[model samples]
Target: MTDYVSTTPGLFPLPDWAKDDLSDLKGHQKHDLISGDEGEEITAAYEQARADVLEVQREADLDRVVEGQLRWDDMLAHPLAVHDAVETRGIVRYYDNNNFYREPVVTGDLEFDGDVAAELETVSELIDDDDDLQAVLPGPYSLFDLATDEHYGDDEEFLAAVGDFLAGELEAFPDHETLFLLEPSLVTDSPAEGLDELASEAIDTVAAATDADVVVQSYWGALEEKVHAHLLDADIDAVGYDFVSNQEDNLYNINEYGTADDISLGLVDGQNTLVEDPEAVRDRTDWVFDQLPVAEFDTVYLTTNTETFYLPYNKFEEKLAVLAEAASLAEVTPA
Candidate 1:
């Protein structure tokens, strides 16, 4: 029998208590207040929110759980944006989404300040088994693309620096089963001539820092041939494709390249309010297998195409159920 595991791309929507806490703190004060007694209160709120989201995932029967990234104000850029080496510039649009993030300007040599590792440490105590938990971090190339580089003049030099910084962060994280290196920028920006090779190298740098299996997940659209080929060559365990956002193109890419590694299919539309029919999702999964060379992978992860923070809390919960049910419908064999 094929074992089925369900997971999310992390960054869940803030719960009511977290929202209330944010409301009380207000504006720039939220960041300022986090260092004092108020910071303790806010920390308590985040912990509660994390616990609540974990309970929801457990109740939904998801095989793995994330810390919900309740404090990631800047989405994928939060970890780097909050670092001392980086400064927040003006607000900028976060890709195609309606949301925004404070642009991170690298003013000095980048260094891992242990913020993400500390956050993971807090969440690690809550989990019964480390194997059932997944940790998430923005991919190095995506971070380099998202930020403004002042310290390193050359693009390749800047990319390598960012990769080293991320590797340090990953090294600090508690042992867990998987690390998801979210790489939406690779898809959004497409592959440039030398960029794909640089990205693969940076990914290898970060992936080597941890014992956990690393999954480099690209969303927002399907990866083009060059980018897909580079990702396959990267030292990562699996590649995730966003089938919901770019179904036909992703299917075509998979058929053309034929993945040799494990695959994660993002079937549920995390950005949309519409809940998908499980039967339709099952059929889609079957079609994906048909396009593969061997019609099998070491593991198949059924997940959301992107972060579910776009959806209303109720809709997000419904989507998780849809993913779990769809995974149950998939045919699997032991690795």
Candidate 2:
């Protein structure tokens, strides 16, 4: 076991490469890595990219290290994780510009694919050398939201199936500090009812199978009364609170969570290019720490939202350096 101190959360950049050897992973077919049409040319590049990120995280000495999401493999692997017997469809663009995904019409019997299991294990191996490295997975509620219903028919049944399947995946990663990340960009427009219960069941199902800590992340939702009420007794060690994606300057409704859990404070900008001010982040975190206990303050995490639209590969490293400074300061400052 590693001699790690579970005090003070730190910042992590979106898991893409900090310095692109050439350019963005766009234009390349999303499925190329898996099809083997691209072979090790694509696979080797991704592994190297992930290695670079691990080295950077090591140098920064972050409390948590993410295995860089280089191949788009597993970043949003839900499209391939479900059973093919289930129908499939795509989500509508909620905004004038939104990233669209094609997914299964999951109505019943959510099952895990061998691919997702192997992907998570691959990520684990990438960062396994780092003592603080934590593996990530798409949260059940968020996955259910993106998973559409075409032929399967019933929305509620689809959600129930997803819940069941996630329970199985959680069991697969039994011993490591796997941190599941739920991306509910749809929350910006339509956050569902009973999210807390939905999220709790998903986490509990996995917890029964594994010792890993489950973390619920809602990257873009505004934590209004209803959302807060739902999260009040969330059953997990960490609950992600996104000020960056929600565009809130501070943690406004965190107290709504009646339970004391770890708070992942998203401090960097994931959807845009404005590098944040280090001092500003420090002040905002101070305000949030005031709401929770001083001891618990150490449990607060720092990160950008799910993706890195903030900067290109080269510039992202510069931005990460600044956020690192803020996380360091947050440790000494009082709530």
Candidate 3:
């Protein structure tokens, strides 16, 4: 009903194929393609790895593919570039790599190395090649979640700075770079009140910065009205929802995501190891359509919640097949 993009569930790190400069490299590291390298061979090696990643993705049975976010370490890792513009203090350490069910709090100001802007051109090009592809940016709040608050007095100031930086990158993606995708997972991870405030600053900033339809995602599983109200009010083009693992306990508010102008319903379980039942997911989609206007369903999208898939490369294709089959059975249009 919504925009069509099948997933092997959660986003897997991108394959080399999606990257430009990496050449023919394959596997997970393929996702990290930077412009400059140690030398021609290193660059060449990166390129080789890059090309293989793309091939795997291209051959992948997915719709509205995400280029594997092969470039990102997870949304939290994105705003690290802010280190350049704002000098912050804090040693970043994860309590757990598998940590996601709850909010991952940052006790200090996270450093910034704003150098990531340099890769915008590559991101844009990849997204452009696949219009159905969704792009990602760190939510200002997530940056807040991770930033070490040293130079910045408090979270608010840190957010303000991150929001400003995010706005330019989001705007640049489609024009100076690629089509676009903005995933704000932080809102779903915390109380809607505080996260909403951060969402407002970040969303409005990017919304004003670009005309590309913004698709704000809440993969943190906080499927409550409060989590999404700000996005709706922000006038963002769409909001994404995930029912992959735990469907939010509250159903009344769930309708907002589907009924709201443009929403991507994440039925494919992107994070779990269990392969989803396409038919079952379709049934859920059916129920969703009852509450939302079937005619307006074009605004909806179907995908896995997030990309930090922990699986190794070999198993992705089969997982991808499951995702593709689910989408096909659900009868969602393929991208």
lDDT at 123, model 3: 40
Ranking by TM-score: 1, 2, 3
Off by over 4 Å in 3: 1-3, 7-11, 14-46, 71-75, 81-120, 123-130, 174-195, 248-250, 256-259, 290-295, 329-335
- Report the CA-based lDDT of candidate 3 relative to the real structure: 0.52
Give, for candidate 1, the lowest lDDT window spanning 10 residues. 31-40
Please say which candidate is ahead in lDDT: 2 or 3: 2
Residue 133: error of model 3 in Å?
4.0
Best by TM-score: 1
1-53 in candidate 3: lDDT tens per residue?
34444632234554424343343433324334332223554445444454555
The digit string of per-residue lDDT tens for model 2 on 156-218 reads 555556666666765665245546556454355344666555655654555455565555666
Measured against the true structure, the TM-scores of the candidates, in listed sequence, are: 0.94, 0.75, 0.71
lDDT of 1 by residue, 1-335 (tens): 44556789998998766787767755546656433234655667778888889888878878778888888888988877888888888999999878999899999988768888888887789878999889999999889888999889988999999899999998999978988899999999864899789888999999999998788888999888888888788788888999878878877777877664577888888889999987788887787777666666777888998988888888988888887777776643223
TM-score of 2: 0.75
**Candidate maximizing lDDT:** 1
The global C-alpha lDDT for each of the candidates, from Candidate 1 onward, is 0.83, 0.54, 0.52
Which residue pairs collide in model 1, if any?
2-332
Q: How many clashes show up per model? A: 1, 4, 45
Off by over 4 Å in 1: 27-38, 331-335
